[model samples]
Target: MSGVTRDDRVHVLGIRHHGPGSARAVATALAELNPQIVLIEGPPELDAVAPLAAAQGMRPPVAGLVYAVDAPSTANFYPMAVFSPEWVALRWALDHGREVRFLDLPANVSLVLADEEESEAPMDPIRTLAEAAGFDDPERWWEDAVELRYHGLDIFHAVLDAMHTLREGHVPDLRTRRREAAMRRVLRAALRSEASTIAVVCGAWHAPVLVPSAFPTQAADSALLKNLRTTKVAATWVPWTSTRLARMSGYGAGIESPGWYHHLFTARDQVVGRWLVRVAHLLRREHLDVSSAAVIEAVRLAQALSVLRNRPHPGLPEVLESCQAVLCGGSDVPMRLVARKLLVGDILGGVPRETPMVPLARDLDATRKRLRLKQSAAQQDLDLDLRTQSHLDRSKLFHRLLLLEVPWAESAETSRTKGTFRESWTLEWKPELEVALIEASGFGTTIPSAATAVVAQRTAEADIAELSTLVETTLTADLPVALSGVLAALDERAARQHDITRLMAAVEPMARVRRYGNVRRADTELVQRVLTGIVTRITVGLPAACTAVDEEAGRELRELIDGVQRGIGLLDQRELRAVWLSALRSVADRLGVPGIIAGRAVRLLLDAGLLDVTDAGGRLSRQLSMASDATQAAGWLEGFLSGEAALLVHEPELLEIVDQWATGVDAELFDHLLPLLRRTFAEFTATERRDIGLRVKRIDRGAGASGIRSDDTTLDHERASLVVPGILELLR
Candidate 1:
């Protein structure tokens, strides 16, 4: 087996990534050896930003972000936590003023060669060791062996020996070989340099092959890395989160319990006791009944379980079990809360303010600071009163980010009674959004500029509906220039657009902006003119659009008609309403119009007082005539009563017409129409449907002239007399 010689200048420390015990051991070993240089396993592209780790605002749980300059989304993160061994080595080297370098293949090459196939199957040394030790879980075994135990420098030596044995006859895949070659190449360079002593910190799996005696010649290492594909890569420091460090988060080197490891690293003594105390406190905060006595018992139980399991110390499993038993009373619900809030953790790290960032990112940071809106990992609800300048600006900023496809905030539903002056939003900042910001940097250097550019680009291809949405978004964002371009595109599209349904769909947003523009102090005259033109075009083409339609098309046209009616209500302009009502009348009078459309048109006319109750009853009676197709009659009823049945309850004439039609239908036709009729009535509230049912019963009993009912002589007077005394007492 390969091993480091006693007199060798290079000391290799094999470590588990993000392992607390490994991190502690690395710091201890580095202090003792005081190596002249330290090497860490990461992309070399990150070396430029490595010094930022020591910056004033620099924090752990941050990552070295590297990405292809041309394609920013093709990226990789080299994350470091407070308990990471490589992080310990890096800080040690930086504090001692020793030379430091990354030992893996450059990100530029790896990113370009990402698609290359592996030459062989990779081996899991940890799993192999765990199985040999009679443990099913490699993570638990490693935690017991290295992470939970304090082995100092000896643990690294043990890991190295075990890995050597494990890899005695194993052949690494091409990517693994190339990565090891890169480390070796970096090692050789450090050896040739003036540094007399070097410390290389890397994953344990690579430790055996990295020893100089394992592959003495440089030619093979050089051959593995020759003429590799490359690209220009940029690197920077960005904040990270503990949640993203979990294995379930799809990170390659993620750990199961970042928060647990963090607690282990930070607490100097009584690891299990401290952890249980924290759990007790968390449970208490959640309004659970956790007593100090329970915490102490939990600690005792954890230690006992560790001993029973033959563990040197209480590991995460023991502590978790103890907590579940004592603090939580075996309830899984509180434990889920513990796992999410304490185990995986919601901790978000920070980077130094002076860390390198794209211009757009910098601008946004400045804007956030100026607005006093601090970024947070936790979700927060923001209720903005747009009448206030600051709130308006904040709303605009969120809208701009949304337009640029950086969804840091999502628009939430607000109470309609709160009026147009208030907007609701949910804000949650994520670390990956930094990469998104980088991707959007090419658009412009500022938020407004980038958002405007995005709108302009999208406007060129936007249909009338898309353009209408864009217009509203741009108006809300308060981008006057982009709004102008979008309006022009909308007008151009609306002029020649033959799809009247699209024209109808555009009305609501246009009418909304025209009506609420005053709240934002925005000019709405242009929107008003555009809306008028759209309404006029809709009225002219709607009659023809309603002709020659199938069932699906008929349903769609009915919905569009409802939408246009709603828009006209929002505008509340007499001229537009008159024109729209006239159009509906034409649709009702036109031949070959779908029964649903004609029925809806008559209903709207009656609601608007353009048609009297008698006229509306005549139209309905005609639609439901004996000669009329049963399916057509059902469609007409569905379109008229699709949303509400209150009209039928109040308008007894209309109800009588429908009742007659229903009673007149043959049993066969009624059976065919039952499903359709049920679906239409299902849309109504229970109260409305009940009221209609009661009215129908009255009509059937021939007592429709009066709502009151006569007394019944068959009433149970003896049973009713029991409630009479109680009713009299309540009345008093």
Candidate 2:
């Protein structure tokens, strides 16, 4: 709330935020009643741009950019697009030779407020409404919600009121309340600034709250926000299109409908019913199926519904019933489609024929024309994905420009498929994208250069966790131009620098490609060679590097080792696995740790399942022989691990280790290890054991079920083993 409110109040124009209809109406209202001072609801950070906004050639969709004075890298933006009410209000003020001012919270403090509540959640009000109305599309649900208004006069007000209420219910937080208070403060200041009647334009939500006489003016450093920061602001106009207003986006200006509201504005004498019929005719011409007879029937149905609801004039509901009957053949089929087209029709805007320009607008037009993107018509069936993966190189500039996340070029895609790296793009030249490109140029000249610059700026401003994500994205790109920036970002995230997840983005990729010289593949050679050379210096300081990794990180290193082995060519597969084994053994020895016997066993089990499992009883028997040594134990474990036997059952002949040690070993020592043997048995569920019992026992369960039973001695031994205290404890 850091804007200037003047006593020279000019005009107060209430409007719907981003409402094209409201903008058009306000423009007319302003021209008819000229004002000297115009105030708008916006972040006061753009106060510096008041002159810029009023300047010739500036355009809408240009944001009033604000960089935090304390941290220049930290920026907050308030964007405007054509068809926005505030922009129109400003233009009218400028045309009347009046001063225009932004009246709202400044960007830095606003961002601080928003950042304090850092939650990126979307509400499900629309989704819930869609479900209630039996429509999956949120837009369609809105149509139904609004369509209900046609039933009667009482219902019409109720319907609009309900929609408004629902909208409030869905906001993540009640920022609007705070925003409205800020707006009121600005409006009161305008009144105190010497103007009798001031023009204050803002979202309709703030209209009821902006009562000047009842609301007192706020001081510059008011109690609500003593810590607020203020800056300059501006406004402009730009061409708009239908698709950009689709609500498919997260942030931007919006005009949910243009054409229908335009009709509502222009044809004051024509009732809404006749207007809808005209819409149906337009739909029919577009091959959308609304016949003239259908419109007539729809009108009849609407009148009947109006009578049924006991209303003098049809609201939105009766019109809907009429549409359903006529357009949808008594079904909610074609009517729903026509409803969207008429009510929430696409957002299409054009430059004003005679309007003062903002500087931002001229620059955007020039950039778009230079890039050969001034043509707005979109070509269908152009799949950029396949084309890129194919041999088509549009140009280095085009390829690089495509990489920037400009939301323009995003078109409505009625496609459903499960595929990676697929995105919907509309590919139009918008003033906003051009503005962004110029803004990005502050960091670097070219698009890639600008991207790198933006990354650096953001990284400089981001916290540790955010910086870590940037590192991951940079690693995925794996381009050299960002190397310095990546390292610097890594440094900023240094509090989390020791986090292996953070370090691994830099480490794992390098490790994979490091030993490429050992491979015979040509596709990955150059990158791998570079990666190996880079990591070689770091790898040379092994103990130092290992200190950054915790035990869990060590386990991940093992997994990475496995991944690297998997990546080796078929001819070198065994060699690669052996290399990892040797490396693991070396690392283990250096750390004075036990060999990874459990890891060896687990890896084997996962890889080959029961089919490759060795006979645990037989292997143990061999390993425990009096002639066996450490080497022999090692050899036996290697063989046992090489063949996976995650499951086991014992036979006396197979229990040679028990037979050899049960009589001679320290009884306590042998008992302590027995739990492991019992756990192996208990690991499998009863059903699984019943099915696989014979496999491990080498008995044909089908034959055993045939009444061929095991001997009495075997049964006795099983009972004794199952009864042991340690074994029983393990079972639990």
Candidate 3:
């Protein structure tokens, strides 16, 4: 039978699963009905695997998916977030003595439900007409009508009518309409036979069509359900968080506005306090001295924010701000990660509240523990004294390549030396892996992480040069950590051309990396540089490098470069000046051919004052030369030389190209002037360098203090940086 339910009058509840307002309404609606034959929208195959849900160790993110039996690879997962409405519906059925059934046509039928023919489909006539109606954004139109405002319970009835029109208007195909129509019949039958008010659950979009009169009714057929595929699937429970939800990841069913909605689900008065307690508890686990005072202050701040914002309940934002003020003391790094501990944690529960583990992972986990593996976060020095001979062999082999215990991994690694065997795993608990593990969960929990580990270890063993796909996938999956790990994994991968598409894909997470801020130090240099590099990479390669959906993204890349550059540029005056000077020089260098993209670079640099090299004032280089002394100044030479960044007068060709754009040089003459400026820097003198750096600094400070990072306390006021100008002068 087709895995999709094949039933008559099947009740389908269209819902935005996990949506608090929807869930609350659905629960209220369901409570009024006691359907004996409650059929929820899941793969019917899950009926065969219901035992897995109750299996002693099944976790979340596990799903009983349906695919073509002949083709196991083409499968669609029925994801189950903890807050999924389908999950709640099933639970209601289980508790109320109802015979719950998944009434979709069997997987085999639904998956391969072809009409035995193809048709040249007609386009929507209304869509053409809608152009005059200002229906430019279809999604926006839908959002306005249905995706917003959920204060009423009669919305279901309103939706029921809308589905009728939507099905005829949207799905013009007769064959597809019949499939949905048959399900409605199945829903009705389930409702009638059970003497129960049946509650049908489906996505909100589907509800408007499936009502009794919305579409044509069709009889369920065995032929309609046959010729599909099936797979033995399992289910599991996984913790979730709002931040990730905000990312709109996965199949788009993950709840949006989790922070906003969570208030409705959880107790209001205690949430902020609970969050603080959880944070303090997590900190305590990490051995941070989070005092009660911190928690109290955080609570007070949350209350203050709630009052100021006119919210009766203190929201996540308030709680977060409070936590940041009290615990972070300004830096939000630890607090964000800690919030994840409370929000989407590593703790996983089994489906059915008691599914058992998969075999391999279970066994491996048992072995690991028996071998006395510490489950706590890994540390710098770890000596796994393999007690058994085979264990010893595995350990030696692991060490031989994957471990690479040259010196650092030898239980004595430090920051100074690149350590071997000092494993750095950026851990994230994907509930899907637990589902993947549940199939193997019987074997033990180790199989999943172990299988992943084996794949990771193999890049080293098999070599990423040959296994380039693995390297790319790793990057696509989680870049900074994954790519960093792959670097070690390859130990010798060649400089494969940059796949900017793959790199840009990491922008979201990479952006998140800057949360590691030490605010007091005032040197946002690290994050600034990272953002600059990413923006630079994108801006330079865009407009053609990535094609497809990336066309839109390319425009965004230019926008993002400006945004990030602006953000970093807003640093306090001194730091901002230093950055501007350095960045402008970079623009000059990058403008040369075969260098990074520079159309945007030159404008940003010159406009930002990094290119003050054309002498806006008198000869500061000569002024500093005759008047400056090294005695009272700590590092005159260093300051002047460092200002080489500001002084980076480009060679002729690039400058001429810029002149063509900004200075309006005639094409032929512009081309001629390009080469001369290109060569100018190669022969520039010390006097020239000193004048540029001194001029930029002199303008900023009037010789107050030349500060670059020389020592932590001391700067290149006039020390080593002066040598660059001197060297350039000597060459001249």
Candidate 4:
């Protein structure tokens, strides 16, 4: 049987969801047909709110939000832009006083079905057909064939024919079949109730299936959707953004460029001129040298490109190419600015204040307004200097939100100029985070209180390492109310945990947070007290932990020792510093410790002034003595001097000792020791390695004084005298 059959009474108006062309065509068709009942393919749950679209200040780029009453997180969005065909059709019905209603399956079934994520099918039949027809991108083909070329009934007919051919080779899953059946049942009921014709606006792909003559039997359709488990759902309108209207936000039927389409729908008469003017405005604001002349040239070039490409109007590609050539000087930097600001306009739609939202989301929005941190869909970079109270407050709110897993703000890398004083964040608001906020509302009423409650709950079962991370998050979030509980938990965990490696690993982050506390003006007395105890335990147990470890275990222990050394270096109390240095001295002198650990121990002792230069030299000689094999001597050398190139670079005596050790080892032993030596030297910077090599060359050739050249002797006096005045003039 044929996939589609014609019916005169039902005017099936197929449309691209957010296409400007489709919106125009649908509007024209609705005006011409003048149907009494308009059945739109939208969630039926939002039918009551449909009239809200006609209300004053009810803007486009807003969405009808439907979520399960039992599980608000199980939600779906049906977003509409100013150029959307459904939006246009609904507006027409509202203006003409025609009855308008949503005819698709309700959100109760859709949200449940959405929860069962289907595995991606290996192939798409529509994509295959587009490819077979020699179009690499199916969307481009759809635009060129149906959207860009047709109007009124021609577009609907073209879409119907294309979808019919595609569907002939495609077999939809049961879920799709059920949805279509439900839609058909609704349309049949509408036809029966309304004597006048009913106009159906739906996705172009569903037009063929919705025809009354081709629809499945009413009895079978009812059985397919009968007795399905459903929960009550509530819906409200929420603001959306142009960026989220793009396909990247995972909207199934999203458009590529909402800004461009909006222009096509509203400003089609002078799209190129207005777009170039917008670009020129952005460039002038950025202080780039753009002018009226450049704008005029860009318009001309866009028209020329359009004519060359045989297009009726200048498309996005033409405008972009013209922009790159005329205004950007063939450089992509200015063009990128144009694309970001103009092509993807940062216009965020607004819903009526009376729209319903979960308490957490409502509270979050209020707090955001109070903090002057406006929510936007576009990603914006924010740099905060902790010295400022407002910036600090913004940072704290972001951290708290992160704790709740809202993920609206992400901490970026530290700023380059002001290291400790500044923090950076990339903030982008996603609509789905409303669900996360709803889930977290069970904790507390506000972001700060909720974050504190959450941290306290997690701290109950957290270990020392996890608690260490939690403490840093709490500090960054500025949650002083929860700090005491987390600190107490940390102290209790630290008292019970005897693993030296874990203790050492946890100390550095805690110490860093404590150090940052002074900058943030946050209370750090508990952190300081906890860190002191942690340091004392690490100092006492480190010597024992270093004993009898294998090479791999030695590497891990070495990292912990390094962390401890760095942590102790940042401590304020002199008594603690003395104890840490004493611990290092003991570890250095101990027998049977891994050579790498002993080397680190000796380096730390030397750095702390516990060992003089003479003592260091004598220790190096003994460690590299002929009594030990090349492997053992190499290991010892690697421990003390692996990452400390400055000492060797400046001190010839240490360099001479290393040279003697290298000469003393036999070729096979040297070959066996090459890897360890290479590993040790690899940590040094390139200049350090090169300088060391040059110093060694000087020592090997005994030419330190023989090759010295006087700078004055090489100068040409007459030439220098001639250029001195010119150099002075240039400098002045």
Candidate 5:
């Protein structure tokens, strides 16, 4: 059977999605046929915004986004590159004053229907044809036969014929049947309209069934689509990227090499040569030493390989292979870069400012422009100094976006010593974030308002830990209105919460807000009062919480204790430090407390200068006594040496005590405790461990009798005097 059935008023041009050769052929045939109306394979709801495709600032490689109005997450993107046949058809019709409309299953119906049980996957017609043609790779076969070569409008007829044969004995699933029925309904409507001539641009697979003779009756088509569940949907234009167009990005109808297809569609002559020159330039930009001679060699090799493969011109594979051999010196490293920068490409499309958008998206666009922050598909690092107004505003925007789940910018690690004024972020904008912005619009119109609304809603069900984190997040985002709700929730949760661990988790984040709130010029008086109350409750409950804990629980409690200590340090409040230290002492003195907890308490006391070196050494000796249980002793050592292992290197008395206790343990006990000992010492730095070992050896040889040598303590006074005279001279 032939592909077209003697329809003089209408022409069905079947083309591949995003296929450049098909695009060229469609444009050529449209000029020749000059149809009065154009129908493309996309969601019909997008017809309202389809004219934006020809807008002045609307660049190619964008997508028409259709989503359920209530459930914005249930969405679909009909992406179009400059070379996509559908895009060409739409632009041509719009430019020439011809009517254009999308003729596929509306996303509103399709999104709801997608929840139904899916049928088994159908056979791949392209793969079947490729296998019949003795090609294993379907993409290569299609590119070689149709995309790389131009056969005018006859190619579409051939594609339609192949698809018809493929469908001869094959049965389509319910979804496909429904979709095809929907397309036929639109075609019937177009036929009944006043338009004298119509051109239908659709996927090659659907073309065979769209012919007038093959189309099912309108009543049958309507019956197939009757009572299908659907929702209210909205459509808009959004920027897209070539990287997202690649098959690797999970687009079902994606092409493998969008960059190569783009080259084929846009370049006027010497496509292979220009592609290689582009590759060479990319490699050179990466500091690879590619020269003109290498580019020439690569082009020659690609042409020769194409001739051997009997191709009309050099394809992507031939050019890539030539690049690997000649330009990259047979290394794949530089070639991988070439594949990313030149093969798949990092091209991000643009949409016109006048294009319709949700309020949230419009606000964000304006905000981005005002902040002088350009959206980019490529990853970029943004360093912000919170002291600067512009940087602070940018930081607030990023934090707000994160709250709304946009995550266009992710917080990266910055140096603590860089102080509270510095923040680092990694920013890379993806097209899908537009959908997120739209979804967030339901919360509020602007970024801050939306983020605050989300946080305030979450605060109702948030636990103490989440409330604490929310408090910090609100403070960081400078959301004063949201911060009030979070702080109230935190205070209420802390008051009723009896879980000491939960209370402890709240301390650090609240402390952080109090410590760093000034850097952002945020009000922290409320946070300070809530934190003080939480600390008081923690001090009351901590000693009892530390009692009767198992080894694992002890370790976890130890970490909480460490965090609390750090939080107290951040506060730097004299009265608060005293109360916290008193609580730690009580835990240390309490009988039946886990040795790990007691040991960490004592170590914290020593670090806080509440206990002297002699007291700490005596406590260590008692803990590691042979009379003590070996396992408990090991736990004590692990906890005591947890963070400050370098103390053993600096303090000879503690090191000597630990050394003697370890050597005095019985062999069986030693074997039992070896893993624990290894684990504890493993936490120590290599240099710390080495220094401790040397100190232990010196003690064994009687050189560290007083924890210091008398002669060394004499300090080489003559050498000190020599240094002092030089220091005085420099000062003078």
Candidate 6:
């Protein structure tokens, strides 16, 4: 062997990452071995900062980061948890004053390999072996193989044998070969040193290959890493979280249940009792009913399940099953709460003040602190009523972060379906957001400036719709600095684009922002100015645009005109409104214009009082004449009177014209018009429809021919007075 001696052979402590049992075994084995040096599998580039893991107030669920010196965004994380075997091993070395080093392939090469190969490795021997053994869950198999069975130094030997057996005919991919070769090279160099006793800890899958007999020669391993492309890299440590660890985020070697493992690792006695107690605590906070009796039953159930499953101690599965059956009453709602809040806790870890971060990340952190917002691995719900200053500030911060493309918070919807007063957000902080924040440093130093820069950058390619959306986002974020630039972009896009539909689509959103600004008390004067210009253009082009089209185009233009009309109503300027209404009146008068649009124009004119009651009745009579096809006339009527039932109810002449049209239509034409009539009537409330029906019935009976009477003679005062006493008695 390259650096082997029979008297003091190097020990390979095989371990499962983040496994409590493995962690315990590693601590015990390291204590007994008393090695002068301990080498752990991590980015070798991060060896100098490995001691940070043991610093005062340092906690686990922390990660050692290594990134390109020139490009901080290109980084990798080797996360550590308190229950992690490697973490325990590192702490052991620190306490014992033993030299420790990270021995994996350097992060520069690994990051490149990772970026190049975005897909997961096709070969996963551990998962394959678990599947072949009829274990549907690989975590269960790992628990049985290592966590449940392994103890003392015996585990080391068992792991090596199992790994060797699995790799008897296995072939590694090129990336794996390079990685293993690097690990081997580091071990050989460590062994060749002056240290007498050395303990090497690594993944169980790599333990067998670390042996000198099974590993490649030192010279061969060196050749594979020599003349490699490399980048200057920096290393540091950052805080992580238990929820992130349990969820595994995207780490390949993550534990299935970090919370369960933590319980196993920390609780000295009454393991089931502690877990159930935590569950009860979580349930109580949510105002759910849980009691001591339930806890006792749960403990008993867990024990019984452990016995039934033939486990040496109650595992997570047993506890979960027991929790589901007894405490949950077979309901998953309370159980899910326990699983998320307790199993995957909301505990967030923090790094020391000395830790390094890019300028943007530092600013972001400062803002988070200022807003009293916590960074959690688990998703959290934030309900903000923009009426409050603090809530508005928080909202602006989230929007700015979004503009930077660092999705720490996302715009979500609240249960309140009716207004803009409330805003809901789902906040989840990922480690990679740190990298993204670092990348965004080139934009600006502060959140507002960076957001402004981002908007400016997007303006180069954004179309009118996109610019309009940006405008709304900017207004909501209260980024006044970015607003001018975004509006300029929108103006530029609008000037270049002549598509009326697109222009009209842009109009409504601007009007919405302007109106909402009134509620938020934001200065919407700029939006108003831009909206005026858009309305002017739309009005100038609309008369010509409304004429001569097919059914689909006609329908589309009608909808667009309707939206533009609604938007015109939102504008406070009378001149712009006058121009828009004039264009609509012209479209209504033009014979070539489609009946649907003409109907809408007439409705707008009537609503604006440009058309009198007499004019509206005449227009209705003309539109519903027998000369027009039933379908076309029905479409016009639907466009004109569908939404305003009062127009049909109060305007007797208009109602008579509609009645005549309906009565005069032949059976086949009536069939064709049935759907359109149904759709129109569907818009009216039951009372309005009932009143209209009664009017028609009265007209049919010649009861309304005499017109409405206001005389009290027809209503007998004596008879009515007699009924009042009975009505009063019934009320009492």
Report the lDDT tens digits of candidate 3 across residue range 303-410. 898788765456566777788788877777787676455554433333443333445435544655564543321123344333344344334322322222111113
Worst 10-residue lDDT window for candidate 4 reads 701-710
TM values, all candidates: 0.92, 0.50, 0.45, 0.85, 0.93, 0.83
Kindly list the per-residue Cα lDDT of model 4 for residues 32-91, writing each as its tens digit. Answer: 888899999887888888888888778778888887877777787888899888899999
Q: Write the per-residue lDDT of candidate 1 for residues 1-732, one digit (tens) a residue.
A: 423456677888887778787788789889977889899999888789888888899887888899889999988888899998888999888888888899898888888777665444445566678789977555567767665553555667778989987878877778878888898888888889887778889888999877876765888788899999899999998888887887422124667789988998898998888888889889888899999999999999998997998877777778889999999999999999999989988777888988989999999999999999978777889999998999999999999999888998998974433237888899988878998999999999999999999999999989999898888889989999999999988998899999999999999878888888888889978888888999999999999999999999999889889889888988899999999999999998998988888888988988899999888888888889999988999988887776667789889888888888888999998889988887887787777776887787676325542454455679898998998785333223
lDDT of 6 by residue, 1-732 (tens): 222225656888876677676788788888888998899988888787877766776877888878787787788877788888888999999988899998888888877677665543544455666688765445456667765676667667776777778878977776667778998878888878899888989877777788876767777777777876778787877778776685443235765567877888898789898999888888788888889999999999888887887665676778898888877888998988877777777666667655777777788888889999998887899999888988989988988888888999997873423237788999988777777777788899888889888888887778887787788888877788778888987787777778767788787778878877865668988888887888778887888887887768988988888777776776666897889888988888887877778888898899889999889888888878999777778878877884668887777777778887887899887877877787777778777887776665445313332255235447788778997775333223
Question: Candidate 1 lDDT (Cα, whole model)?
Answer: 0.84
| lDDT by residue for model 5 (1-732), tens | 454467457788987778787788799889977999999998899899988888889987898888888989888888899988889999999999999998987788888887874954544567678789876545557767765564656666778888888788877888888888999888888999988788899887888888888877888889989998889999898999988898522124777778888998898789889999898878878788988998999999999998998766677778889999999999999987887887788888999988989989999999999999988888899999999999999999999999999999998974443236888999998989998998899999999899999998999988998899899888888899999989888888788899999989888888888998889998899999999999999999999999998888998999999989988999899999999999999998898888888988988998889999899889889988889988998888887888867788888888888887887999988888887888888776776776776776577424543444234565687777877765333223
Where does the lowest 10-residue lDDT sum fall in candidate 6? 700-709
TM-score computed on alpha carbons, candidate 3: 0.45
The reply for model 1, stretches above 4 Å from the true place, is 115-124, 131-140, 146-150, 247-251, 414-418, 663-671, 701-732
Candidate 6 global CA lDDT score: 0.78
Question: 1-732, model 2: which lDDT tens digit per residue?
Answer: 101123423334444455444565567656655666777887654454455555655644444445544443345444455556676776677667787777776564565665565443433443555577665333334334543333322222333244456655444344444565676666666666766556667644444345443354465325556655543322333444444443422123333454444454455564556776775776677687677777777777777776776655554556666666667667665655565666555433444323323233344345445655533523323334422432122222333343355544443457532122333444555435534543444455445565566566666776544554454344333334564565455454443345433333444433333333122121333334433332333233333444335445544554443433333322243533444344433343243221223234333433433222244444455455655443324323332333223333333233223334334445565465454434444545665445343443443223431234355544677667866775335444
**Please, what is the whole-model Cα lDDT of each candidate in the order they appear?**
0.84, 0.47, 0.45, 0.78, 0.85, 0.78
Residue 199 CA displacement from its true place in model 2, Å: 5.1
Prediction RMSDs, each to the true structure: 5.5, 11.7, 17.9, 7.3, 7.3, 7.6
Candidate 4 versus the native: TM-score?
0.85
- Sorted on lDDT, best first, the list reads 5, 1, 4, 6, 2, 3
Clashes of 2: 54
Would you give me the overall lDDT of model 4?
A: 0.78
Better of 2 and 3 by lDDT: 2
Against the true structure, candidate 5 reaches a TM-score of 0.93
Deviating ranges (above 4 Å) for candidate 3: 1-13, 51-62, 65-73, 103-106, 109-192, 219-251, 256-269, 283-312, 325-327, 351-383, 386-732
